[model samples]
Target: MKATIRWAGDVKFEAESGSGHTVTIDGPPDHGGKNQGVRPMELMLLGVGGCSSFDVMHILKKSRQDVTGCVAEVEAERVDEVPAVFKSIHLHFIVTGRALKEAQVKRAVELSAEKYCSASIMLGKAGVDITHSYEIHEAAE
Candidate 1:
C-alpha cells in the first residue's frame, strides 16, 4: 500500500512499491523527457486493467473453468482541459479456454466490474465513466 517516487530528471521518476518492485515513469520527448518509460496516466490505466483482470481470473478459476489464457485490453479518454483527468475507461477481456461456458465467462466479467474490481469501481465512483466487455476464444487443439 506504500510507494515512493524519486525524481530522475525533468518529467522522469523512479517509482518503487512497498513490495520492492520498481518502474520508470517519464513523459514524452516533447514534454522534456526522453520517453524512457510509461507515463503516469498510462500506469493508472494499466492498474485498473490489472485489478480487473486479477478478479476475472480468480473467479473463473474458482468456478472450475478450463481457462488457458487471458488478456485485458484497457482504453481510456481524458478531459480536454487543465488537470485533465480520465473521462471514461473501457476494459475488453479476451479469454481462451477449452469448452468455456459463455454464461460462466459473462458472470465472471460482471462480477469483476460490478463487485470485485476495486480500482475500476473507485474510478467509477469518482465520476469517471467505466465500462466492460469480454470475448471468448477456444483453445487450439
Candidate 2:
C-alpha cells in the first residue's frame, strides 16, 4: 500500500493512492488553509471507521446473515496538548437486515475490534481507547 501527498500550496495537499485514487486535504481557515477538503485527522477517523465497517459486513455475510445495509458512525476525542493525539474513539454501527441476530452482530463487532480491524487495533495499541457498539434493525419487506 503506497500513497503520495503533494503540497497544493497554503496548507493544502492532494493525496493519490497507489490504486489511482485521489483525495484533497486542507487545513482550516484559521490555520492558513482554505478548508477546501477534509482535514487530515478527519481522514484518520474515517479510515478506522471504514476498516471496521468493512470487517463487520464481511463477517455478517460469511455468517449467512440477511444483511441489507450497514452504517458506521465514528466519533473521537483528542488531547488538548501538543500533537493533539486521539484520546478516545467510538464506533456506532447501525445494521439493517431481515431478522438480524443480535448475537451475530455482537460477535462480529467484537471480532473486528479485537482481531480483524487493523486500524482500530493499531490505534488501541497506541493507547487510543477505542470502543464500539451496534444497533440491529429489521429490514422492511
Candidate 3:
C-alpha cells in the first residue's frame, strides 16, 4: 500500500503506485500548471469513486445479481479557505443488467458505503459528507 510522486516541473508530477501503475498529475494554468493531466484533488475523488464502485460490483456479484455494466459518477465540493478540503461528496451509481432487482441494487450500495469501501469509510471518519445513490437499468434483449 505505497506510492511515489515525483515532481515533473511546474506543478506537475508523475505518480507511481506500488502495483506498478502510473499517472500524471498537474494543476490548471491558473495555478501555474500546464494542465498536462488530472489534478491531484481530481485523482483523489476518482480514487474514492473507484474504491466504492469496486465494492458495489463485488457485493452485487456475490448476491447473484445479473450485472452487466456499472458506472459511478462522483461529485464533490471543497471549502474555499486555505488548506481547502472536501466538504461533501456524492456518488451516483448507474448499474445495468437484465432483470436487476431493485432491492439488490439498494443493498449493494448500502453495503459499500456502510461496510466494504475503505476509502469511503476513511473519508466518512474524516467528517466528509459522503452520500450514495443508484439507478438500475435493465438491458434490452
Candidate 4:
C-alpha cells in the first residue's frame, strides 16, 4: 500500500514497494537517461495489465476452468499536448485452456473491467477511454 521513489541519477530512479520489491525506472537517452530500466509510463500501463490479469486468472480458477495460460496485450494512445496523458487504452486478453468456455471468459473480463481492476477504473475515471476484449484458445493436449 506504500512505495518510495529515490533519484538514482539524471532521469533515473529506484522505486521500492512496501513488500520489499524494487524496480528501476528511467527515461530514454534523449531525455538525459541511460535507458537502463523501464519507463515510468510503461510501468503504469503494465500495472493495469497485471491487476486485470490477476482478477481474470482468479475468476477462471474459481469457475473451475482448465486454464493453462493467459496473456494480456495492452495498447494505448496519448494526446500530443504537453503532459501527453493517455487518451485511450485497449486490453486484449488471450486465454488458453482446455475447452475454455467463451461465456466464462467474457464474464471474467467484464467483472474485471466493471468491478475488480482498480487501475482501469481509476484511469477511466480520469477520462481515459478504457476497453477490453478476449480470445480463448484451446489448450494443446
Structural RMSD, model 3: 0.8
Residue 45, model 4: lDDT of 96
User: Where is model 2 poorest over a 10-residue stretch in terms of lDDT?
Assistant: 131-140
**Ranking by lDDT, best first?**
2, 4, 1, 3
Return the clash pairs for model 4, or none.
none
lDDT for each candidate structure: 0.96, 0.97, 0.94, 0.97
Q: How do the residues 82-101 of candidate 4 rate in per-residue lDDT, one tens digit apiece? A: 99999999999999999889
Clashes of 2: 0
Question: Lowest lDDT 10-mer window, candidate 4?
Answer: 39-48
Residue-level lDDT tens digits of model 3 in 12-129: 9999999999999999999999989999889989999999999999999999999999999999999999878999999999999998999999999999999989988999999999
Please provide TM-scores, in order, for all candidate models, with all chains considered together: 0.98, 0.98, 0.97, 0.98
- RMSD list, candidates in order: 0.7, 0.6, 0.8, 0.6
lDDT of 1 by residue, 54-136 (tens): 99999999999999999999999999998899999999999999999999999999999999999999999999999989999
TM-score of decoy 2: 0.98
TM-score, candidate number 4: 0.98
The true-structure Cα RMSD of candidate 2 reads 0.6
Pick the winner on TM-score between candidates 3 and 4: 4
